[model samples]
Target: MQQTTVAKTVTYTGIGLHSGKSVTITLHPAPINSGIIFARTDLPGIPQVAAVAGNVTNAMRATTLESGVAKVFTVEHLLAAFYAMGIDNCLIEINSVEPPVADGSSLPFVRLLEEAGSVEQEALRNIIDVKEAQTIRVNDSFITIVPYDGFRITFTSINPHPMLGVQFGDYEINTETFVKEIASARTIGFMHEVKLLQDQGLALGGSLENVVVYDDETVLTPLRFSDELVRHKILDVVGDLALVGRIKGHVIAVKSSHAINTALAKKIIESCSK
Candidate 1:
């Protein structure tokens, strides 16, 4: 397959998820093999940060990439859009540390990229083909990848809440499947944890419209899918793994978080070098 990039520039403006501040992002077409790069236009000199596992500085509540003094937060949503859309290279210019949390799902970014369109490049795609089984474990959560002809994911999310117990999803991911099955899954949070997160300066812009919030007894918002939570987990896996470029494998994840997902990404990067 050939590398691809947006055919034209597109811009979107909204409120940052963590910063709770207004920001604008402009997506520009990039040359072949340039990969996805993020530029912090608000910072001096407009420093750029590459979307790679090695540059990840934080994965607490979200993925954060850093290079030198420049940092970009909560990048997984946009990155997942690029991956599922088959976009190989892009230059993202943002005016804040975090991208807008549009409906707390990748669907908005998907539509934005669709508006920009896509054009094939002269070079071929750089695909990471998983040759052998690789697994990473963190506590009870684990992620495993095995050789496969195409990108696929089998995810299981386990929550003790009465409203959410165990959810499972299996999908062969592509543009069509992603748009239909995964892109609309919104991020989730619990009412009990809201104050704690806010005290730590997180989820400042989250709302019922942007996040699927659950209380002790029931979910505050209507679910898009019966298993929307797990579907969103799969969405996050796709986004976090985007750091390693295109992948051809079957991934199985259980209660995986950003840290665990990015650890698998780092593991993939390390194996490629050997």
Candidate 2:
């Protein structure tokens, strides 16, 4: 299959989840084979950074890519939107270190990309298909990629909170489901964790508007889906795998986080290359 990118630039502005500062990001048409690269516009000379598992040096609360003195944080949702939409190459230029946490969902980015108009390229795309059950375990959490004919993801969580109990979402990646099911699922957080995250200088851009904040028993807004939390988890997984370069095979994750996801991605790429 051929690669794709939008014809024109799309712009968006929102607050950074960590920096607590407003940020403006623009998606520009990149030459074929460029892949998804991030450019730090605020720095002198505007250095560029590649979006890949090898570039992901930090996977704390969110996935972070760093090279030399430059870094970008919280890239999963944006990456997932592009991956599920089948965008193969593009330039993500940002005025800040992180993209805007727009409504804490990929919906805004999805809309922006559609408005910009996507175009097919001449080069054939590359996908890393699983030849066997490739698995990686970290402590009690584990992620595995198994052989499948097309792209699919299944995610399960063990959060005890009422808003986040055991839940699951399964889908064969396609344009219709990507926009309706995955893109609208908002990233969620706990009300209590907010104070600690703030103390650590994280989630500074988080608010009830962007993310679904919950107390012990109450969700901040109406639930988008009964299993919205799980759906969002799948959303995150899709985004993280986008760093793998192109759409691949089935990925199954159980009780996994950003750290474990990136770790599994590294292992998969390494194992497949050999």
Candidate 3:
């Protein structure tokens, strides 16, 4: 398959998940082989940051990428949307350090991409076709990928909360399946963590509207799917995997988190390069 970029420009504005500051981002078409790059529009002279695994500095609750003095936070959802839409090259201009946390899922970003449109490029895609298995783990959580003809993912989340429990989802990822099945799964959190996060100066934009919170007693919002927690794990894996640009393999993850996800991404990049 050939590479692709946007057919037209699109803009999105909303509050950041962490900074809670209003920021606007514009997606612009990039040349073939340019890859996905983030530009800080608020800073003068247009400093750019490449959205690749090597630049990832933090993945606490969300993925953050930094290069020199420029950084972009909470990028997983937006990257997942790009991966779902088959967008290979683009310049995302953000007015601040974070992308908007619209509805806490990839849906809004998917909508942003739909509004912009996509066009094929004249070059072949730069992708990794796993020839051997690669794995990484953080305590009980682990994720691995092995050789496969096409891209597929199987994810399991082992949260013990009654609302979450043990849940799993498997999908042969493609443009249609990602949007229809995984794009709308909101970010899940425990109500107990809200106060802690705020005290730590994080998740300032998170709320009942944007995040699905579960107290020990019950789930705060009606779920989009009974297995949405696992589906969102699938969403995150897709975003983390997108750091490899293109992938052709099968991945199995259990109790995945951003740190482990980004670690697996680094392994994929290292393996593919050699």
Strongest candidate by lDDT:
1
Model 3 lDDT-worst window of ten? 156-165
Instruction: Name the better of 2 and 3 by lDDT.
Output: 3
Model 3's TM-score against the true structure: 0.98
Best by TM-score: 1
Instruction: Please state the error at residue 241 of candidate 2 in Å.
Output: 0.7
lDDT of 2 by residue, 43-130 (tens): 9989888898899998888999998767899999899888877788889899998999998888888888888888999888887887
Residue pairs with backbone overlap in model 3: none
Local distance difference test values of all predictions, in order = 0.95, 0.86, 0.91
How much is the lDDT of residue 223 in candidate 1? 93
TM-score of each: 0.99, 0.97, 0.98
Q: Which wins on TM-score, candidate 1 or candidate 2?
A: 1
Error of 3 at 13 (Å): 0.6
- Which ranking of candidates, highest lDDT first? 1, 3, 2
